[model samples]
Target: MTGSRSSSRRALLGAGAVLIPVAAVAVPVVQRAAERSAFLALCAAWHEAKDTHEQFYADNVRTFEDEQRVAGEIDRLDNVALRLEREIAGAPARTCAEMHAKAKVAERMGERASEDIAHSLVADILREGPGA
Candidate 1:
């Protein structure tokens, strides 16, 4: 009876030993899967925002600026935003300031760069009479 008890104890210990290695390997795989899920979630959210929302801003053009030049400035702001994304290469956990570093860059780009993209997007509305 004592021998049977000893054999069962060894079997339990053997099972635990095998499970230890499996758990060790599984832990990192699970962590990486979680990180991947987080990254994809952020990316998906960013895309959803772009698809579902429109940016709005006011642009007061000086007497001298042409429409073509205004459009080009908006394009340049977009390029700056794109460059910032590449530079930041970051996760969603980044601070709001960090996330908007691009817009800040656009604001710095020129007097109207910050508003150009939104302005160009709705030029017709601005040109048309008010909604009231």
Candidate 2:
């Protein structure tokens, strides 16, 4: 009877060892899925902003001052992109909600830049020619 009990214990331990690796694999899969979803959402928002900004510039409505302003804004946006990329690459990562919040902030910044450029262009057109 004692020998039978020892055999049963060993079987249970062996089963537990097998489960550890399965659990490990499952955990990373779940984490990767969440990260991919968050990344897709973020990319969607960024693309929308990019498309809108492109449309805004399609009017050929910029002035000399507007060009300078846009140049500065583009520099700033580039920096933001680099920083966000780094943050995304390094973990402990944030949830989808947190990523959306960050994306919203970026969207707002882009919107503000667009507005500023439009206003500058309109003002320049009203004030004088391209030389001014």
lDDT of 1 at 131: 60
Q: Each model's C-alpha lDDT?
A: 0.49, 0.55
What is the overall TM-score of model 2 with all chains considered together? Answer: 0.34
lDDT of 2 by residue, 10-112 (tens): 9999999999999999999998888767665555555555555565555433787765657766555565544544443332224445444444444555644
lDDT tens readout by residue for model 1, 1-132? 999999999999999999999999999999867865664454444444333322411353444554455666556555655544343243332223332433333344456443443343234234333661
What lDDT score goes with residue 44 in model 2?
54
**Can you list the residue pairs that collide in candidate 1?**
none
C-alpha positional error of residue 96 in candidate 1 after TM-score superposition, expressed in Å:
28
Model 1 has an lDDT value of 0.49
Steric clashes per prediction: 0, 0
Candidate 2 least-lDDT 10 residues: 85-94
Model 1 misplaced stretches (Cα beyond 4 Å): 55-88, 91-132
